[model samples]
Target: MNAKKKDPIKSLGIYCHVPFCVKKCAYCDFCSFSGQNSQTIADYFKALQQEIRSFALARFNSDVGDLAFPVVDTIYFGGGTPSSVSPEYIQKTMAVINEVFTVSEAAEKTIEINPGTLSASKAESYKAAGFNRVSVGLQVWQDELLKMLGRVHQQSDFIQCMEILRSVGFNNISVDVMYGLPGQKLEDLTATLAELMAFSPTHLSCYSLILEAGTPMTNLVKAGRLVLPSEDLEREMHWTIDRFLKAHGYSHYEISSYCRPGYESRHNLKYWEMVPYLGFGLGASGFYNGVRSVNTSDLKEYGRLIAAGKSPAKYEPPMSEGELMSEWMFLGLRKLNGIDDADFKKQFNRSFFAIYQEAIDSLLKAELLVQDGSVLRLTPKGQDFENQVSLAFF
Candidate 1:
């Protein structure tokens, strides 16, 4: 095998999946089960730590080649609810991480929390555990909507959570919210926005509701029990959020992500920047060098493989350079700022203008793309047609 083929990207982000929850949300299609998930939380953490240690050793043998080192730049704990883990569990994970990887002195360590699960003590403990950032999913402010979403927390709980987060010295807080639900109105989104902005979180990730197959939400849609707003209405609502947030000094760096200046998500940027990060645990996917791989989604299988001292990965393949380049365009265009021409040229040693001339011409002709210097970004019209513009790359 070629040595060049095995070299991963420079930076490392370790994503630890904590797939346990108190109650499953109605619209949730994630790899989470309420009681069943909690049963294995402790064991999963143990497996995850061992997996990271193995990956670190492999990287030392493969990528580093000559050095004894752990080169993780970020550590992200995401899940059904990472904060739902007992404080001791979180501490144990951090301890394992410290023992294995040489985390950056200023690494962006983060953990996801739900309002009901996160408390002042836990928040402070997380801070002490080296988690500098926390993202809380406060999906909707309306109690009715919260109930409908089957969220275990209330609007007051969200406020209380934020207060606790502040008291616990979590400065880099992120708020996650959603829109475009079957029963959601534009006014409802406005109310949600008002509540979120009042908290002045450093970062916000806004996701449109996606009805995944096998979920109750999908069943409702198929059964005609749910009627989603038309695409035009959804786009309109998205644009409204975009405009409002931009006006309020939130950097619309990504399609669904906004941040205060200097607060853009570093771990997420690793993805769009086409940097490789290790994904450990069930259902986690990662891109390293030109290769992409995903771990088995089954928790039992994951544990079995880890216990056997093996990667839980189901499939791993090296992507062709063309495929990698296409993915670069795909991911980069999702950022509102657009991709840089020079970076593309440097990476592929070819001009993007020459490569996708017809697509570019057609997009600009349709007034969907605004070409400013060597940069190309979607116009408001293009944002409305983002899917079509993205398809141009493929």
Candidate 2:
């Protein structure tokens, strides 16, 4: 019999950040800009293309010496709002990426969209440009809440956007929702979920509101103009989402992510599983070759540096074995199915139980973690207190 053919190369994920939005949300702290003229937007994409071309495989091969070139298996266009710009920019950027990288034919390509920013023309353009997935930012169903969050789009915009996307033959859709917002009630969350479920989105990301320092929303809470939900109420909201989506045939595969079976975000899984990936654009973070890289947040600096043939990123020293193991445990535990001891041993050449026995014993005794043969997973209660459980492993 002929020997089984070996796979040619390992896979890598690509994240292209488009840091432009129509307007800034009150709660957002991501590295994004608004109110830019056409010139600025055009300049940014030019710089972005330069940044993409800068990572040509020849250059990467010289840096890594003998490291095998990775085939790009996933590409994610995330942003302040990727859809706010002209579809031609997206198309051209995709063209540049294809020129520089060895992207797989069946790669999962995704783009983030703001509801109001998308149109029928843009939706069809995205389909022609080869985007297989769309993640829409629809934090809540109530117009009042959207206004409070400084979101430009309302429920109607979301509905229209979904229709346009479907009309363009795009079916792999993910809707982002938020819970535990200031003045948000349990009933409000359920109502939002109910309205969104009508769209039958293949993936759903339910996030809790986190007050970032210096953001407008945080200032309101600090000044007593708004109040976040109490801890008990927030916990109830989390569980409510869990029960509601699971009943609707969505799998709660990761913390804050639910998907119809087999529809999990492949790009996101790369982060949790510690697979290699490259991040292009301002303030993007990437990990590969055991090193973590973060691009400069300053747009002008990023453009200038790339123009000068220098990287605008800060590279961290490669992670030690202990650090990698800790990250593996924490990130892996974010999944509902948790981590595998056998997989850990295979990666590190050490037994997971032997290393984390004390921490594991304490958590298991407290009923926060359960060991099912070689697999360890968070209990329902443990999921609620994920931070505390993670601290034990650290």
Query: Whose lDDT is greatest here?
Result: 2
What is the number of backbone collisions in each predicted candidate, taken in the order shown?
0, 0
Worst 10 residues of 2 by lDDT: 1-10
Each prediction's TM-score against the native? 0.93, 0.96
Model 1 regions lying over 4 Å from their true place: 1-9, 37-39, 61-70
| Highest TM-score against the true fold, candidate | 2
Clashes of 1: 0
